[model samples]
Target: MRINILQHTPNEGPGSLLEWAQANGHQTFVYHPYHFGYLPTAEETDMLFILGGPMNPNTDLPWIKKERQLIQELLDKDAPMLGVCYGAQQIAKTLGCQISEAPAKEVGWAPVYRKSKIVPGLPEKLLVLHWHEDMFEIPKHADLLFSSNDVRNQGFIMNHRIVGLQFHLEPQADNVREMVVNDFPYIENSVLNQSAADILKTPVPEENKKTMFKILNYITGD
Candidate 1:
């Protein structure tokens, strides 16, 4: 599989997703719009793995709007795509849904229960990394995937090939710890309800690869 990661921040790169791609003999490319400006074509990637970011999708930035159009075009192709955090918000915006304030910021390690048929070899609930103040409404055509007390629309699947997750199943313990140490300046302590240590303290196994990979596999099955 070939995966293209749309990275937003220097801190939140494609953690587990990149690892899976490498381990499974897949090629990977990353786009850092924070430094690279608007991208050229969404058609460049076989599978799109949009990573998390601190920027809200509703911001009046031209890049945000341009990315929205690009995402719409990608969705039109009906290819396998996964959007996380701000990426998910962009996906929701492309689908004509609301991307506004969540009930509250969901920081730290949170639990998300699975609810859709798309999930492959799924469990009841899983501990996923999370750090976002914004959330998206479930698109009219999307099925509910997972949720917590603060947010109902934690994840959604727009079509058979596209998936959007507000949580960060792509990051594990060591990466979370790295973010806490390296990206501490970016986090808003007032909004981020949990401390960095507390977030990293959450349970996440080194072999917790199947859940996210299951979503990817279902979309890109043989």
Candidate 2:
């Protein structure tokens, strides 16, 4: 399978997702639409993974607009796709959902509870990495998957192929370090936000990687 990853920033890359692809013997490609303004077509993408970023989908930025269009195109074909954080907001916006400021900026490790049993293998409660200020309204006809105390919409699945997660489950230790270093400014002193040392010092749980692979497998019909 040809898996195309749309990365919006330098720090946020496909961490465990890339590992999952490699381990499964699938070809993987990464594109920086923010840097080059290029995106993979639906025909070329057997599976699409949109990573997190600092940007919001509500903005009028050209690259963000283009990426949303590409997401819409893929959705029209019922293509398998997973969007994380900002990318998830992009997907919601494309589906005519509203994007607004979250009650509070949630950063670092947080617990998200499974709201529905639509997606198997997801625990009733799981600690995942989060770094977002904006949240998306669940798209029409989509099933709500998970929710956190700070954010009601942590994840949703649509058409059984489109999945959106408002947290970071793909990041390994190294990926978390890069995110903490590069996007440190986004983290502030708040109840939900964590300090740089705390974020980096905490080990990446193995269950996070396992759940990530399960979601990938579920979306790709594995």
Candidate 3:
């Protein structure tokens, strides 16, 4: 399978998702639309994974608009896609859902409760890494999958193929460190946020990788 990733920043690459693809022998390609201003068409994408970023979907940028158009094109085909954080917000906005500031910025390891059994075997509550100030409203006809105390729309699943997660489950240890180092300012002076040292020192749980792989498998019809 051809797994195409839309990465927004150098620091935020496809961490465990790349790992999963490699272990499964799937071909992977990544596009940096924020930097390169190019995106894959729906015909070229067997599966699409949109990674997180600091920018919101509503940003008045040409590449943002193009990316949203690509998202809509892929959705029209019911392509297998997974959007993370800002990527999720982009998907929500394209689906005619609202994007607003979260009650509080979530930038650390936080617990998200599973609200639906769309992806079976997820624990009732799972600790996942988060780093975003904006949140997306669940799209119409989409099933809410997870929720955190600070963010109600942690995840959503639509058509059993498209998935949107507002947290970071694909980050490995180095990926987390890079995010902490590059985006440190977002966590400062926030009660809901965790310290950089704490966020980095804590080991990436084994279950996090397993759950990510599980979601990948589920989305791709493995």
Candidate 4:
């Protein structure tokens, strides 16, 4: 399988996704609009994995809009797509939904309750890494996948192929450090803020590569 990853920012680039892709013999390419160049053409790849970012997906930045457009095309094609955090918001906006301030910011290990057939190894709930101030409303056409304490709409799936997880599954050691060191500005001084500094003290237990591969298989498998 070939996966095209839209790395939203330098720090939040594909984490476990990249490792699994390589270990499983899947080809992966990264195109970071903030670092590399423009977004790719819709036909450039078979699968799309959009990583997290501090920017709101609805921002008027030209690159943001381009990403939204590309996502819409992928959704139309029923291509396998996974959106994390801001990427999840992008999926919502492109699907004609909205993202707003969550009742409370979820920062740290959150128990995401899986409510659908989308995720494997999901209990009635399971602890996952979470860090976001925004929550998305599931698109009418998408299946609601999961929820958490601070956010009711934590995960959703579009046509079984497009999966959106608001939590972080790729926060390996170095990834967490990058987010803390490079993207620390988003933490500010707010009490609601959660940082890598805090999460490192307590991290989400890493998902086994097999579980992650199963997740991708569920999304990208024909």
Q: Which stretches of candidate 1 lie over 4 Å from their true place?
A: 38-40, 185-193
**Scored by CA lDDT, what does every candidate get?**
0.78, 0.90, 0.89, 0.77
Q: 148 in model 1: Cα distance from truth in Å?
A: 1.0
Question: Which residue pairs show backbone clashes in model 2?
Answer: none
* 10 residues in a row with least lDDT, candidate 4: 203-212
lDDT of 3 by residue, 1-222 (tens): 898899998999899998999999999999998888888988898888989988988889999998888899999888889999999999999999999988887888888999999887888888889888889999999999999987788999999898999999999999999998998888885546578888888888888899988888888888
The C-alpha stretches of model 4 lying farther than 4 A from their native spots are: 185-197, 208-211
lDDT of 1 by residue, 146-215 (tens): 8876688899886678888998888766678777788665456524466766666667754356688787
Error of 2 at 93 (Å): 0.5
**Candidate 1 vs 4: which has more lDDT:** 1
Q: Which 10-residue span in candidate 1 carries the lowest summed lDDT? A: 183-192
For residue 71, model 4's alpha carbon misses the true position, in angstroms, by: 1.2
RMSD of 2: 1.0
Model 2: runs farther than 4 Å from truth? none
In candidate 2, position 46 carries an lDDT of 85
Return the TM-score for candidate 3, rounded to 2 decimals: 0.97
